[model samples]
Target chain A: GDKVKQSPSALSLQEGTNSALRCNFSIAATTVQWFLQNPRGSLINLFYLVPGTKENGRLKSAFDSKESYSTLHIRDAQLEDSGTYFCAAPQGGSAKLIFGEGTKLTVSS
Target chain B: EAAVTQSPRNKVAVTGGKVTLSCNQTNNHNNMYWYRQDTGHGLRLIHYSYGAGSTEKGDIPDGYKASRPSQENFSLILELATPSQTSVYFCASGDAGGNGQLYFGEGSKLTVL
Candidate 1:
């Protein structure tokens, strides 16, 4: 069984629409981080949260340690936002992070 | 800018051959990690290091070995490459605490035949 699981393996959205991605953690996650892999296969860090919510431009992320889950919300999506999104959490008492399968997002104009 | 650089952006290897992926970080982070990404598996940690001379096994370290010789360099070695090892490898560096933000490299694409 996967320690970290992501929902909606794939998603499609219009250029100006909004969408949210979710991740469920079976491990005791104290903190969570979100990353976006662009078309060039480069991974970019989006947000790093500790059981709280953070907003950066059009992207907002929330992590709930008590519920063992996290959410990433994208507002007013753009073509540049079309990429694979991944959520990861640090392993208990270690620097290692376990990742979810990722959500492939496509923002079409 | 803080960066993590990986060599040989792409490589193709034969079975029973040796493959090495190297990572260098300019972030001065103490924690470094190597992870592999597959179609259904987003990213699984293969190995990690706390510092220059410390290496630790992650969730999936069976077919790979890792070395951290200095604060800025870490390497992943595959003694006997197999078809199952074909995937994109990523190296990341982070602060000492587990809750710090991580910086990842561009990734290395490896194909095994």
Candidate 2:
């Protein structure tokens, strides 16, 4: 079984639309981190959460440890956002993070 | 910003040959990790290190060996490469207490024939 599972394995959205990606954790994850892999193949750290919500420019993320899930919301999507979104959680008492399969998102113009 | 850099951005190796991927972090983080990403699967951890002189096997460590000669340097060694081992390898560094907050490198693409 997968320790971390993400919903909507693939998604397509139009520019200026809003969308959300979710990750459900089967492990007792205390924290969550979100990453964006761009078309150039660079993994960019978007958010790191600890059982709470965080909002960045055009992006917001929430992590619920008790519920064992995390969500990332993107507002006014852009073509540059086309790539993949991944959420990861650390193994209990270890630095090794288990990652989700990733949500492949494509934002069209 | 945390900077994690990987060497040999792209490489092609033969089967049964040796391959080494290097990672360096300038953030002075105590923890470093190596993971490989395949087409349909998520990035899987192959090995991790805690500070200098310590390396631990991760979930998939069978064909991979890791070394942490210094706090800023970590390397992943493949004794005998195989086509199944061809994937994009990423190196990350994070603070000891940062939980899972990791900064990743650009990733090294390895192709084994």
Candidate 3:
């Protein structure tokens, strides 16, 4: 079984539209992080959450440890956002991290 | 600015050959990690380190080994590369407190033939 599961394995949204990505954790995760893997294969850290919500520009992320899930919301999508979005959480009692399969987001013009 | 760099952005190896992937971090973070990404799968942790002179095995450490010689350097070793080992390897560094924020490198693509 997967320690973390991401919803909507693939997504396509139009420009200026809003969309949300999600991750559900089966383990007792204390922290959750969101990353954006660009077309060039570089991972850009978007948010690191303990249990609350965070917002950066048009991107907002929320992590609910009690519910064992996290959500990433993107507003006004752009072509530059066309890539893969991943959510990760650390293993219980260890520094090791577990990641979701990732949601491939493609924003069309 | 925090930065993590990976060497030999791309590599090709023969079956049963030796392969070494290196990572360097300028963030001065105490924790560093190695992960592999393959199509259809999430990023799988291969190995990690707490700090200098410390290394720990991640979930998938069966065919791989790791070393952290210094605070700024970490390396992943593949003693006997196989075709199944082909994947993109990423190196990341961050604080040891489980802050959830990890600085990642550009990733190294390895092909085993």
Candidate 4:
């Protein structure tokens, strides 16, 4: 059973458009972290949330523990932003994280 | 900022042979973890450690073994390698409470033939 599940398995966007990715958790997740695996296959940390919202550049993320879900919003998408996005949360009280399947995003000019 | 490095960026192993992937982190964080990345599966936890000299089994630890000799070094051992073991392995370091976002290495690609 997957503790975290991501929606829209894949996405395509035009340059300068905005898109949002979502993750639903089946477990009691206290915290959430978002990561982006770029075209080069490097997973870069995006945002770490605890029931609130955080914005960085063109990216914004929010987590709601009570709702058991999280969202990563990408604004003004660029070609370089094309990649897979993953949202992760810990299972119960452990330090180990359970990850979602990931959303493959492609932004074309 | 945390620094996590992985050795042998790429490796190839013959079936039934032994393979060891090494990782070192200089963040001084007490929590470290190893995960594997596959096409459909985002990332699966293989092993983790709270501190030096301690290794804990993760969700998928049956075919893999882990060793944490010190705070800076952690190794994942694949004894009797199999083709199914081929994947990209990642090493990460984070705070003990696990609230901090994990700092990751570039990743190590291992191919088992």
Which candidate should be chosen as best, given DockQ against the real structure? 1
Estimate, for each residue in B34-90, the C-alpha lDDT of model 2 and write its tens digit. Answer: 999998988999999988999999999999999999999999999999999999999
Error of 4 at B19 (Å): 0.5
Give the clashing residue pairs of candidate 1, or none.
none
What is the lDDT of every predicted structure here?
0.94, 0.94, 0.93, 0.92
Candidate 3 residue A3 Cα shift, in angstroms, is 1.1
Identify the CAPRI category of the predicted complex in candidate 2.
medium
Model 1 misplaced regions, further than 4 Å: none
Model 1, residue B1: C-alpha shift (Å): 4.0
Model 4: residues with Cα > 4 Å off, grouped in runs? none
Of the two candidates 1 and 4, the one with more favorable DockQ, higher being better, is 1
Query: Given candidate 2, what's the lDDT at residue A102?
Result: 98
TM-score of 1: 0.97
How well does candidate 4 reproduce the true complex, by DockQ? 0.78
Write candidate 3's Cα lDDT for A1-109 as tens digits.
9899999899999999999999999999988999999998889989989899999999999999999999999999999999999999988747888899999999998
lDDT of 4 by residue, A1-109 (tens): 7789999899999999999999999999999999999888888999988999999999999998999999999999999999999999987778888899999999999
lDDT of 1 by residue, A16-61 (tens): 9998999999999999999999999999999989988999999999
Ranking by DockQ: 1, 4, 2, 3
In angstroms and one decimal each, the interface RMSD of every candidate reads: 0.8, 1.3, 1.2, 0.9
At residue B50, candidate 1 shows an lDDT of 95
Q: Which of the two candidates, 1 or 4, achieves a greater lDDT against the reference?
A: 1
Candidate 2 chain B: worst 10 consecutive residues by lDDT?
B92-101
Error of 3 at B68 (Å): 0.8
Q: How accurate locally is residue B47 in candidate 3, as Cα lDDT from 0 to 100?
A: 95
